[model samples]
Target: MLAHNQDSLKRTPLYSLHVSLGGKMVPFAGYDMPVQYPAGVLKEHLHARAAAGLFDVSHMGQIALRPKSGKLADAARALERLVPQDIVAIAEGRQRYAQFTNADGGILDDLMVANFGDHLFLVVNAACKDADEAHLRANLSGECIIEQLADRALIALQGPKAEAVLGKLCAEAPAMKFMDAGPHEIAGIKCFVSRSGYTGEDGFEISVPAGDAERLARMLLDNPDVLPIGLGARDSLRLEAGLCLYGHDIDTATTPVEAALEWSVQKSRRSGGARAGGFPGAETILAHFDGGASRRRVGLRAEGRAPVREGALLFADSAGGEPIGKVTSGGFGPSLSAPVAMGYVPTNLSALGTKLFAEVRGQRLAVQVAAMPFVKNTYKR
Candidate 1:
């Protein structure tokens, strides 16, 4: 469990190392975080696309759970009562992205569940860890164990050349495939390393003991291809990848069906099936499958150089008449070299190439519903 004392935010294992590298510190999720460095957001985004960048994500929470009596399969099944994924079929050392939902089918939080040896290792967002932990503890069966890895530090190395840069630190790095996870020693420090990341690129997430985090971070940064990245670039990179940001793109107000994340819900969870609808809000979510969602999330491309920020109003046409929806997340994409955004629109208006307009200040900018991820993903197979 994380220490709730005020001093917990004072420093991370890489605190001094981040300062040494010119990391601009800011408060985020109850910890001192780096927003960016002297290289700026654009440069960092490009660098991660071509090379590798080290991100200090130690603030994320890592927790482990195991069946108190029987095998892990039963515990995983219990978890399926909250999420829609078929966790019983999840193999060992592999992670599956899933979300927690409320009774109304709204998302509580999205997290990664890795089935380790006889246990489930969960990596959840720091901002929601307290609530998530309470939810899990109250929902899970009594015949299970929960252990929090708050003392561990997490780091991500992502990009096209990530493997090459990580290989210098661990010889076994080259053998890891996409979504595969295993333990490896980096310069004598052991870490739970996974070949996955938020950026739509080849990468690995290294989880190490809090004490050795700084040493390993320095070693990775020492590589010519690796630079320190922060939360600002992280958000833009994920947005450009067409990935959802929990609070902005999704929430307890948005169901998985409307969020275009039906892929996370398995076939067995369908309406009236054998394993049908065991989770909270299952009735509402399963109904969305047979019929359809009221509003659907889609990509938006704005005309001209002006970037549309969240809360911007969307109009039907260039005339700036009726308001259809609002911008959820919008910014200038460093990779696409253009302004990109995501928001919900009427199901009929969600089609690609549909014409609409985003009102920027007094100007009604010409906008269109477009295919997402403006940039193609390079995730390794």
Candidate 2:
């Protein structure tokens, strides 16, 4: 990490391309990037669901882990000590979403791990990249070689037509199912393509050399179904899909079980398995799974037009009874045509159909605990 002038934010390789495409620039994660294009956030979001949208995500960190023993299982075993998930089970050319947790079971950062044929590839959050690299080095360097892929750029192509659009460029892209990653050549440039994205739609996340990012982006944008999207739409899309936005829905204060993410923890890592309870904070996280967490993360549906926002207080009654919980990620869902949010509330009040009220701007707004994904996920199987 290096000191930087607040006014002089960093820019990605696609800065000039975004500017040329009428992008609205803003500061995000220490980078001056596009928040939206001329078509606006709402349209950008809908376009991704209807057709296809290309997004610049080069701000995220990409790292490679190579095992000195030449055993891929060694790399996976090394990561299990820091996170709760079963990384060793991820087959070749597939991806697994996981988090780096601290000793207290609090998530340090959420990341995506891909098992390429010979080594493991990781894509960590942009803001936590430095710290994540440090943590990996301090804990697993003796078992595996860690290399940061800083010269690469990441872009996501999402929507119903994403497969058709990318398939036209690389014949092998559409062959990949959800969470699959494979190497391919697009526009005569080599890249690693993954059939996954933050958006809940079927899509591909392409990682290419930073020097060739703009060219590849331009080629994809030339398609009739493809349009450039920005961060504003990216947020709304992920929210409607009920995906957590790191620092918001999850943080150092939250654990996998409390966040309703036990599904990500492999069965082998839980109690009763032969190799269970070896990861950090195993006692705290495992206990919650058996005894139930005191508080749970849940999805809320706003009863009115007002969008419930993060930090809003939750009450069990409209009369503003004692606060029960608080909103973590709240926003208007473009696809749902209603406000959707996720929050933390007492376990007894987390079941679907429970009535609740969110305090917005001093006014209590009625809400209901609802099933997540405010919209359905359209990922390619």
Q: Give every collision pair in model 2.
A: none
Cα lDDT listed for each candidate: 0.86, 0.92
- Which ranges of candidate 1 are over 4 A from the true structure? 1-10, 272-274
1-381: candidate 2 lDDT, tens digit per residue: 234554579889999999999999988998989999999999999999999999999999999999989999999999888888888999999989898888788889999999997899999999999999999999999999999999999999999999999888898887889999877898679999999999899999999999999999999999989999999999999988889999999998899999999988888988886668778788888898889889999999998989999999999988946999999999999998889999999999999999999999988999999998888989889
Predicted candidate 1 versus true structure: per-residue lDDT over 299-333, tens digit per residue: 89987888988888888877836888888999999
Model 1 accuracy (lDDT, Cα): 0.86
Badly placed stretches (over 4 Å) of model 2 are 1-7
- State TM-scores per candidate: 0.95, 0.97
Give the candidate number with the greatest lDDT: 2
Query: What's model 1's TM-score?
Result: 0.95
lDDT of 1 at 208: 98
Residue 220 of candidate 2: its Cα lDDT? 96
